[model samples]
Target: MSDDGRIATDGIAERECGEPQREPPCEFCHIAAGDEPAARLYADEQTVAFLDRQPAVTGHTLIVPRAHEGELFHLDAAATAAVFETVQTMTDALEAALEPDGFSVFYTSGPLVGTVEHAHVHLVPRFEDDSVSLALSRRRLGESDASELVSAIREYC
Candidate 1:
């Protein structure tokens, strides 16, 4: 039995995420911990899905890991899986409920790209002629540039 739209988990989220909890408490963490108000759609041991308070489009939902990882790359394998699983679930639910022509699912990793420090995935229901634009600037890189980029990224992996 759960209140506040949170799905019941059998306390499986007791495992530590290894990331130091933020001092001021991230807003998403508050939402996940049920200490803040949110239109919660779903919750599991590791993740929570809720309607975005400041939505880019109708039915905009956010899938967030219950543990506070400030960025996507900071998430460990289990948290990553749980976050994406919730993303897929929320996308399906949004598609069925809103019946939009398409959808935009995205994540911004850093403070420069993302507004909030907590890592989360945004699923926005897109309709035809919607004003929202998720488009990024297009660029064609030279062969050497592209090859160098790939090599540089692969070095870290």
Candidate 2:
């Protein structure tokens, strides 16, 4: 592992904050490769679940693919399915273990919204009055604006 806590893999080193240098390995890849130490929750052939070092809540968990895929869109159908299946299992186990008021399952795809370059699903355990707020700002879109946006999105879909 590098001094910044990133695992050195494929001849690249990662920084502690998930930054890569020289096409460095992503943090998830390091963790998946067993090059870095993490509080592992579960693992299978295609996916692995582990406790987040900087957790939103006490039981925050991250689910990641075994192969290095930086973005959610980069994953194929089988990889996507495998990751979500592990997520489902983790959610069930977290509910049993923590018994929180609710839960939030989220995925961060890009640098604008996510810190890690590697694709990951976060299973955040939420209580009634938890400090974490995953809420997004609300806005009521006008009919024309909403229709336009929907149409634009549907083009890619």
Q: Could you give the C-alpha RMSD of every candidate to the true structure, in order shown?
A: 7.8, 5.7
TM-score per prediction, in order, is: 0.82, 0.82
RMSD (CA, Å), candidate 1 to true, equals: 7.8
| Stretches of candidate 2 exceeding 4 Å from the true structure | 1-23
Worst 10-residue stretch by lDDT in candidate 1?
11-20
Kindly report which residue stretches of model 1 are placed more than 4 angstroms away from their true locations once superposed: 1-21
What TM-score, to 2 decimals, does candidate 1 have? Answer: 0.82
What would the per-residue lDDT of candidate 2 be over residues 16-109, giving only the tens digit for each residue? 6665543544678778867789999999999989999999889999999987777866889999999999988998999999998888999976
Per-residue alpha-carbon lDDT of candidate 1 for residues 1-157, written as tens digits (9 for 90 to 100)? 2333333355312214333334444789889988799999999999999999988888989999988777876889988988898888888888888899988888887668887888989888999978998778988899999999999999999
Would you list the C-alpha lDDT of every candidate in the order shown?
Answer: 0.82, 0.86
Cα misplacement distance, residue 11 of candidate 2 (Å):
7.6
